[model samples]
Target: MSGSEIVGDIAEGALLARAVEPAAGEAPDGHTQETACLNCGTTLCGSHCHSCGQAAHVHKTLAAFFHDLLHGVFHFEGKIWRTLPLLVWRPGLLTREYIDGRRASYVSPIALFLFVVFLTFALFNLAVGPIHVEPSAVIAAKSGGVQAEADAARELATTEARLARARRGAADRRSGKRTGVRS
Candidate 1:
């Protein structure tokens, strides 16, 4: 760090302010200390490395990490908006278009299934927290009926069975329906 070298660095920083070419890894967004690609030795010309597709400035902060986690999950380059309606209303058309090599505009079927599965389990866990099995007598009393606890127990068993089947995975539900169709 001589004074002359400090002036040179200041001049380069000033170049960014002007209409001239900015330094490597210095985009309009943020300045990166990286001059060359971390993954490949190629000089970065943009926010993403031109040679390899890795981002020039990888965020190492905790906030950045969480932001990436959320963005990666939720933001599929705004393709979800194009994907969901077709998937729901015109599934055959969606599948045909995807298989016909027009996939970049929509989320792939496998990716949609995976995201739905993750969301389903996350929401199911949140909704079903801890299971509390109360005694049958309480249920009959709550109903204000004079029926025996045995009748209450049977009703509870039937309701529990329905809930158990409802909680099964999508594949399991489909298979169960197929089995029913076959029989």
Candidate 2:
């Protein structure tokens, strides 16, 4: 496929993302000591701001940052665990419940659809890799004859050396070494 088509496909997948919500007053462990929200200057009566709807706690630590990042990227804030089984066994009920506005308790239908689509693509990508091919004749046309053969031999040797070094590194890690063994 053309580069534009490939990019368009990726963009289609990218559009429906970022479903996971943060741990708010609605969710558990949303306690905040501060009296005012960091955003909008709203008086904090609860764990989240009423005016801007930002979390009042506003975690600054590295762990919380990663937690939020994971949640944001994968929608792993406990909704997928609840949504998927129901989507499989009782799809009609799940659809009805989502339409009836019981959406907060499960992943949204669109988000779940996008997740499953990308997951299928990921499994295929890992198993099969890139689908296109550049012909050997094209390579020979670019470099030609004896020089091409020498270049190919040199490239093969370099690749084999890298593979051997990687294997040695893997063996070192498996043997509980602090560092990889140098070639």
Best candidate per lDDT, number?
Answer: 2
The TM-score values for the models, in the order shown, are 0.33, 0.34
**Alpha-carbon error at 56 in model 1, in Å?**
23
Query: Which residue pairs show collisions in model 1?
Result: none
lDDT of 2 by residue, 36-62 (tens): 766456687887778766567755445
Q: For model 2, where is the 10-residue window of minimal lDDT?
A: 16-25
Q: Cα RMSDs of all predictions?
A: 20.3, 21.9
Residues 1-183 of candidate 1 have per-residue lDDT tens digits of 999999999897767655454353355555445677765667878777787565667554456657655655676777899888988899899888755434446765656666889999889889987666678867867676655667889999999998876655445666664433222
Off by over 4 Å in 1: 1-75, 131-183
Task: Give per-residue lDDT, candidate 1, residue 10.
Answer: 81
lDDT against the true structure, per candidate, is: 0.68, 0.69
